[model samples]
Target: MIREIQSQHILQALELGEIESGQGLNQEHGLGRPGDTRWGSHYKTVSNVTALYATIVKVLEKIGSNKIYKDDRVKAITVMSTFESFEFVFMIHLMSEIFGITDKLCQALQKGDQDIVNAMTYVKLTKEGLQQMRDHGWEDFLHLVVCFCVKHDVEVPTMDDMYVPRGRSRRFFAKVSNLHRFRVEMFISVIDLQLQELNSRFDEENTELLICVSCLNPINSFAAFDMQKLLRLAELYPKEFPTNDMTMTALRHELQFYINDVRQDARFGDLKGIHELSMMLVETNKHTTYNLVYLLIRLALILPVATASVERVFSSMTYVKNKLRNSMGDQLLNDNLVTFLERDLFSRVSDDDVLERFQSMKTRRMLL
Candidate 1:
C-alpha cells in the first residue's frame, strides 16, 4: 500500500485514485484509535464536486471559443469526461482554495483555450470517462439530497462575498455547501458542460463522428429532449396532436397537461425527476444543512461507503482524543480534524514519535 507518510503531491494524486483522507494537519496526537468523527462535514466532498459542476458551463463556453482545440474533438470530449472523477473535478477549482494556485486553475478551465483543452482531454471518453462521471454524479446528487438533513440548513449566497475566498478555502466550500435548487443542476451540469466542451473541441474533419454523435444522444436524453421533441412536433402539426403534453384522447382533455404544465397539472410533471428530488427534503423533513455538509450525510446513509472511511478516521483519531479529551478545546479539536481530514499532512511527524506514541497508548490502555 502507498503510505501517506511520503509526499503530498503523490498523495494528492492518490486522492484522485483511492487514497482515503483523514482529518488534515489540524489534529493533534494523530488519527485512528478512539473518537475521530464529529457531527460530520457541512459540505463533505461532494459539495465541492457539485459546485465545480455548477460553474462548468462557463468553462465550456470558454473551451468552445478557441478555434484550435475547437477542431480537436477528442481532446475536448476527453477533457469534458475526465472531470467525472471527484479528484479531477475538485482540482478544477482546487487552486481556488489556495491563494496563488486558485487564480491559475480556475483560469485554466475558464480560459477554454486549445492547450488547456488538450490537457483536459488527455483522458477521453473511455471506461474511465464513464466511471468518472458516475462517481461525480452520485456524490453530487446524494450530497444535495442530504443537504436538507444538516443541523442548520444554509441558503445559497446572494451577495457573493463567498466568491472571494480568504487564504483558507479559496471560496470553493461556500458554493458547494449551499443547498439551493435541489442540486439537480449538479448532475446535468457535469454531463452538459463536458458535452458542449467536447462538441466545440471536436474536429469535424477528423476523429470518429459516430462516437461523438452517440455521446450527444446521452446528453439529449439527460436534458429530456424526448419531451421537447413531442412539444415541437405538436406545435408544427396541432390537429394530429392529442394534447400539449403527452399524446391525448378526447376523454382526457388534459392529455399531456401533467407533462407540460407546472401548476395546474398534478405532480408538476414538467419538472419531472427534479421535482421529486426537491420534494425529498419535504418528505425527509431534513432541511438543515447544505453544500458539503449535505454530501456527508448522503455518504453516511450508505453503510459500505462510510465504513472504510470511518475506520480510517478512527485509526487517526485514536492518536489524538486519548486521555486529553478534557484538555482539548474547540481550536484543538478543529485543528486535529483538519489534519485527520487530510492524512498526507501527518507525514511531517517523526517516525519515532508515531511509534512511541502508539506504544505508550498500548501501555496506558493495557491493550496488546
Candidate 2:
C-alpha cells in the first residue's frame, strides 16, 4: 500500500516536470487554485492544467495503480478518463485562448488608474481578437491540440469520422462529423456568441455622451479635447442652465472662458487624471468660478470611478461576508468592509493619525 506521505512523490514529479517544461524561475508553479470571486482566475486554472498535463497524467496513473486505496484508485481512474480525451483537450485549449482575451479586459477595468479612453480601446481590441480567432484560429488551435495529444501518447481521434452521440437512449441525435461539430458548433458558434454578447454589452450605447465627457480628461495634455463636445457636455445638464436663448449665449461664453483659462493655467498643466483635475479645481478655488463645467467633469469622472469602486467593494464583500459569516450584522459587516476595501488608503495613514481618530471616536475607559 502506498503511504499517505508518499503523495510528496507526486509533488516532486510535478516539480521536475515544471523544470523540464522551462517554466523559468516559477518552476514551483503548481496546480492553480482558481478563485470564485475573480473571473480571470479561470484562465490561470486552464493554463496551469495545460502546462502540467504530462505531470498530472503521470501522478494519476500512479495513483490508479495503487490497489489498497480503492477510493484513491477509483478517483484517479475517473479523473484520467475524464481528462485524457480529445474533447477535453480541445475544450481546455479553446477556453484558455478565449479567456486570454477576456482576462486582459477584466484586469484593465479593475485598475484604480483606469482611463475611459484606454478601457474603450481595450474593449475594441478584445472584440477584434475574438473575431480574428473565429475567422482563422481553428487550424492553429487544432494543430496545438493534436501536438499535445501526440506528445502525451493520448489517442487522437479521427476528425473526419462520424461522431456517434454517447448513450443509445438519446433521441434525435444530429448527424455530424467530429471535424464539422468541433469546428462549427463548438468553436465558431461559441466565439460568435461571445462576440455578440460583448458587442451588446459594450457597444455604442452611451458613446456620444462618453466622448463629450472625455474632452475634460487631463490625459495626454487633453489632446482629444473638442470644444464642440465640451459645449455638448454643458448642454446635457439642463438643470444647471436655463433653456433660453440668453442663457445659452452666456453659457457658451462661459465655456470659452474655461477652455482659455485652463489651457494657459500652470496648475492645470501638470494634472494627470480626472480625480486630480477635480481636486485641483477645488485647491485653486476655481470650482465655483466654472461651477457648471466643474459639475460636468465631476459627474463624468464619478460614474466610471464609482462603478469600478463599487465592483471592488462587492469583490471584497464576497471574501469578507461569505457563507461562514452569513449571520454577521449589517453594521459590523459594513465596518469590516470599509477597512478591508480601503486598506490601500489606510496603509499610507500614520499610526499616530489612526490613534488620534480612535481617541476622538469615543472617550475610552483607558487610554487607547
Candidate 3:
C-alpha cells in the first residue's frame, strides 16, 4: 500500500511538471526493511519513512477507514496515531542522523576484501561525528524537529513548558521541562550511548592491535609501515617473538631490512594489502630470507579474515539447514553445509566426475 501510494504520487507530480523525467523512483528510493547484519539498511529504513511520511499517513488512513477486517483497521489506526506524533518524528530523525554516521563503517566491515586500516579510520570518524552531534547539534536538531511537527500539523510542545507524564500525577513525580526530557534525556543521552557502545566494542587493546596490524599495509609504497608499532605487535605475540631481548633485537633488524628491500623492489610497489604482500613475499623467495617478518605478516592476516569467515559459515547454516532437513544427522548435515558453502569450488567439478566419485565410494551390484 505504501508503494502504491508513492507510485501514484510520483506519477501525478511528474505529469504536473513538479518533477523531472529523470527523477523517477527506484528500488533504493522505496521503503527498506532493516536487516540484522546490515546496519545501512536501518539508515535507509528511517530515511525512506521520513521521506514518504505523508504517503504512509495516507495509506494508514485508507486502511483505518475502508478495511473490512477489524484487526487490520485497529492496527492501522494505532500505527497512524503513533506516526502522527512529535516524539516519533524526533526519534526517526535522530536515528537517521546517527545511522548515517556509522553507515560507512558498516559498509567497510561488510566488504569481502576488508581493509582493517580504513575500517579503523572510519570508526574513529564515526565516534568523532557522534561526539560533535552531541555537543553542538541539539539546538538545530530540535528546531528541525519542531519545524517538521508544525508543517505536519503535529502539536509541537513548548520546550519551556513543564513535561507531564501521560499516566502520572505531577504531585507524585519530579517536575521536568520538555527541553530537559527531549534535549537532555533523548537526544544527548542517545548519542552518548552510541559513543559508549563504539568505545566499548573497539576498546584500547583491539584498536591498538588493528593499528599495529595496519603497519603491514603495502599501499602507497609501504607508507603505513611503522617500525615501533610493528615491534609492539610482535611483542603482543610472546610465543612467536619470545620474551628475550635477543629475539626482539633480531626482529627489529629484520624489519629494517624487510622494509628497505620491499620499498625498493618494483614488484612490491603496486601491492594493495597485507594478503597480497604475503603472497608476493613467497613468490620472490624472500620469505625464507626474512622469515620472522613473514611470520608477523601471517599473524596479522589471521584474525580479521578468519573471524569474518567463521561468521559467514554460521550465517550459511540457516540456508543449509531448513525445515525440510531439520532431522538431518550430524555427519550428513556437515557434508551438506560443506557442499553448500564451498559451492564456488564445487562449481568447477563436472557431473561425470561427481558420478565417478560416488560410484567409487562402494562396490555396485552390477558393473556392466
TM-score of predicted structure 2: 0.83
- On TM-score, the leading prediction is 3
- Candidate lDDT values, in order: 0.38, 0.79, 0.87
Where does candidate 3 clash, by residue pair?
none
The candidate 3 region of ten consecutive residues with least summed lDDT is: 20-29
lDDT tens digits by residue: candidate 2, 33-114: 8877576788888987887777688778888997876779989988999789888888898999999988888888778777
Tens-place lDDT digits, model 3, residues 26-88: 442677578876678889889989889988899889989985766799999889888997888
Full-model lDDT, candidate 2: 0.79
Which portions of model 2 miss their true places by more than 4 Å?
Answer: 1-26, 166-172, 232-252, 318-332, 348-368
Query: Which candidate, 1 or 2, has the higher lDDT?
Result: 2
* Model 1 C-alpha lDDT per residue in residues 294-330, reported as the tens digit of each score: 2222322332232245555566666777775757887
Worst 10 residues of 2 by lDDT: 1-10
Q: List clash counts for every candidate, in order.
A: 53, 0, 0
